[model samples]
Target: MAASAGPVLSREEVDRALARLGAERDAVESALLSLQDHPGLRLLDGADLTGRTQERWAVVGQGLPMLWALFDRYSEALASARAVRARKPRPGGPELAELSELLTGDAVTVPGGAPDGPQRLGAPARLVERVSLDGLMDRMNAWYATVLEVVSAADAVWTALPARIDLLIAELRRVQTLAASLGVRVGGHPLGDDLDALDADLGGLRTEVRSDPLALWRPARVPAQRGTVPDGGALATPSGVVDTERFDLAGRALDGVRLELENLLRLRDDAEERLQGVGDLLQRADATLAEARRARGEVLAKIAATEVPAVPGPASALRERIVVALELRQSGQWYRLAPLLDALEDAAAKELARARQSLTEVTQPLAVRAELRGRLDAYKAMAARLRVAEDPEVVERYEKARWLLWSAPCDLRAAAGAVARFQQALRPAPGGPDDGAATGPADLVDAVDAVDAADGTQQGGAWAGGEPADGQAVDGRVQGGRG
Candidate 1:
């Protein structure tokens, strides 16, 4: 941004400035030459670029010729200055001033922003342009930097994202092959659909990254880093090189598909064990069902006027499905087996839970009687603690409830009503510390104890022997549903 037209120089200073101009001319030419041959620029030149890169690079391509023309103009001006100096021995004031202006002032005429060559930077609308020697050098510096920015940013993205995507594509190929061998699917859709989508997205991304990399960059608030050309001199710093959010998304999606395929492969390795576990769960379910049937008989004999839920037959169908799963596993049809195993395992677990629940249902009346008895005793204890046991209403209700509860073949529905009556009389009377409010009943029967009547519950019921929660395989044995 700084452009200074320096004061008149001495002859030696003028000569030094000219020599410096020559050095600067060489530096500019080298920078431009390197840019012309840069691989990234070559790609840009041929590619049908899109988006912001298309717009910006078009300006660079058009503007490029002006740089060469200006460089030519600078050389001629230097040659003319040299010729004048050589005309007089130990040149005087006029020769020195002319040399001084040629070194520091806008002493050259360059091609304009016309139809043929690169445009003058700011005055794109102008046909002709003039800049001092220092100005010409500065212009080339800025122009070279711009060219590098486009070329470097595009190459950076090409380097960063495409190679990773290619590696992912390679991994994807392996996954696809594995999936095809096993006939795997993701949520009922073949992996080919995902592969197609991934190919389209990543392929499009690679092309776009090559052609229009600037579109992927983050907007830079600060200026890009100025770099020296490989040969010599400065080039423009490339702006916001690569923003990988899109690339990252595509990569993760690809990984997810690959992981899904891998999971199916793993399922093949352990399908037999998994099927065996399912068999174990079904066996446990059968045992629990038998226990429920036995318990129902006991409930019918012991609890009067109580309904017991019917126990289902053994979970033979679920166990039978294991044969099919084994066949699939043996054939390496992992996709089919994976879903089947999922359904079969789920069914086995529910069967166990259902069997346990049936046992609980059949024996529910006995549990109710026990719960009512406990509540009755709790209320009695609370009454004694409150010194209300002697209240005639409490005494009468408690005795009647106790008689029914203690009887064999207890009518639980009637007995429950009697307990409720006993509890009603135990409420605090109005106009005391109680103030007519019924103090809540004691913490009795808050929960019906988990009625696991199966052979060995979790403590002694369903899926005994360190039950695996949810029909999961444990030590190659499936166990779950401690009800």
Candidate 2:
């Protein structure tokens, strides 16, 4: 993994760094002691020490020296323990009777060789010792590196302590002044009376440092309550303080105020805009109400002009009866009369819908007059077809049907049935009668002829009454009839 960038530590932050390193060193020391007392290492036996066994023993031996170094650096008591352990022998009787006999007087038996009593321990023994010693040296090197790092961090913190104290003092003072201006009181706080107490504390620190520069080096001498000081001495500076920490804090506080002010201003503007919209809506509503009143008057005039007789009482009473009949038809209860009623209902519905639409159009803005005109034109077009029917009977039947449909309290179903019958009778039968018999055209013509003949006879009799007398009469019949 790539190394992450470390925190940007000011001089004051460095002292905090040193304090953390000291704590870590103590934890490391504790870990080393635990390793030393591990039961497996203490139980090591010397029988059949193969290459793999040798490697394991070498690791323990190598680790011992580094452990010694770590103990030496971090704990005086542990260092003394390590020294005693180094001087001690393995936990068993000696493998050779005497050190001199094993080295010079005795010859060891050589493996896979004939009757040489014993061979001298030489290169293999030396190699085993070297491996163990190397492991011990590696561990020591690691401990040395760790101790150096801790010392470096501590020294750096000590060197920068004075400047860090100055910065912290300055920041505290600035915070104090602002808190006072805002009327904020840290009541009952152990850091004394708000910003004032903090300022005194910072001043005292600065005076202590000037007199004895080493005062800042000691962590215990520095006030533990420094963070609790409300404003310290930094906040008491003038409006344009050049210190970075104070300036940054003030900017943040002012930025929050600026945001709040902007939000309130935006809210006020939005409220004004909404108020204007409401006024426009009210004006439109008033205009619509006025138009509705005028249209209502026009509808009353139209109703009054209708020549059809009122069925009975108020128009509302008649309307109620129609509504009841419609409801019955719609409920599917009027099975026998349903077809005829349905036709009448359709016509009534169309007429009512048209009336309502007309009322709506009258109330609508004048800009919509074109739409109203188009609807009227469509209605007139529909009526024109009925007016110009070729058969007069058909035309009469249609007119009667329409009248029944629109008339209040009329027997709408019966009227629709009659109209349907008329329509059926008007249809010409194929190749049966092409003489317009359905319309009774021939009968109508004959009736007209008979009426004409009767009128002539009457005229002739009146003429005879005023004429000269015809004397001859035969069998009681007039001699000169109109024929």
Candidate 3:
């Protein structure tokens, strides 16, 4: 019997085991105390928790007392072994046997064996339940870990979401105040009914997050095997754990409201400037139309046998729309005024452009008649410069051309033809290059006819009154020139 027991543990081995067990008892005690002092645990204890955390905490709360009870039992068991081992420097076989049983055998008795209530209500239980030192430690570790996980997850949400929700709610109030000042309206309500609804809902959402923070708990994207507090909480970060979908929705809605308010405020600032721009455009358009009407009358009085496009009247409709838009802006109906001003500005710009175009078209006939008059005078000057001003054919053609040019309501085509004839009569006519290249008045008439035909129809060759270009000629004598 002595040999069997001595082989179980030598003196040094028995002392080593007691020291290790004592260290383990101290470690377990420290761990439990730290858990009790944990901020997450204290908050969970005080909070009126809701949802899954509420359900799980009820189970954890009951086990706390039993957990302490089990620790006391473990400590007592360690104390007995320590006392026996301390009795003498070298313990005898009976003392070693007792120490061995206390340390290694099933030494702690628990009344129900379960910290929780019995599994079956009416079922009979054993008279006694005994657990080894290792078994009790394992059970306590499991109970401690289970309780802390619930506490940590709940604390993670409480700490993160309510603060964010408060900030969002405060921002909503600012948006509301700014909207009121801007006179911003959406669909008959202030900032639309949704913003109001969100304002109200966000206040309630904050309360919901307080009571039911676990509902917002979600798994991390990478799903860490363990977490920060080491309670096996799996909340890699408190911020990462909250499912902020509602908070994010509220934020988006609030941002939209702020952005819209900013746009309306800018519109209010720029409204007068934009309206002034439109008014200036309308004034310019009206002035342009007046100028066009006067030009139309001048073209009719001064030019003959030419078509002039008539000017449309000033854009009265755009002016009326601008007036309505100004009234809407003054009344602070920015929603109505915004689109109206946009259309008004566009129409006013187009009206200004249209007025300018009308002025250009209306004066075109006068411009053409002036060009013909200038051409007739240029040819007459060329005749005088060439010293043929008094030749009878030249004089006759000049008188006819002068009659057409000087007369009001001139026939420009007949005048242009008469000028061409007079011009041809001034210049010596083309014959063969070897014939000293001169022909009489009938040939001059034929040359004028050729010029009128080419100018009126086909390209190439006119009476330039110069030597032919490219060694080519009109009837082998003249090169075409711009008149």
TM-score of 3: 0.76
lDDT of 3 by residue, 364-473 (tens): 65554565556556666655654566668878988997898778877655665676566656556444222222245455445444544643422223333322244331
* Local accuracy of candidate 1 as per-residue lDDT tens digits, 362-410: 6666666666677677767766765668889889988988888788777
How does each model score on lDDT? 0.67, 0.35, 0.67
Q: Which residue ranges in model 3 land beyond 4 Å of their true spot?
A: 1-7, 111-128, 185-190, 220-240, 374-403, 415-483
Model 1 stretches with alpha carbons more than 4 Å out: 1-8, 114-127, 185-187, 190-192, 219-232, 287-311, 316-340, 349-483
Residue by residue across 1-483, what tens digits does model 2's lDDT show? 112133233333433433443344454555455444533333232223334334334333344444455334334422332343334343112222222122222112112211111121111322112111112223333433332222222233334444656665666655554444333345622222534554565565444433333222323321111111012111111111112343244335444533433443343334334333433443444444454456545434432222221111112433454555445434432322233334444544444444444435443322122222232233233334323254576567556655654444333233434444333333334444444333454443343334335433232232112221343211122221111
| Better model by lDDT: candidate 2 vs candidate 3 | 3
Per-model TM-score, in order, reads 0.61, 0.23, 0.76
Q: Relative to the unseen true structure, what is the C-alpha lDDT of residue 199 in candidate 3, on a scale of 0 to 100?
A: 73
Among all windows of ten consecutive residues in candidate 2, which has the lowest summed lDDT?
233-242
RMSD of 1: 13.5
Give Cα distance to truth, residue 104, candidate 1, Å. Answer: 3.9
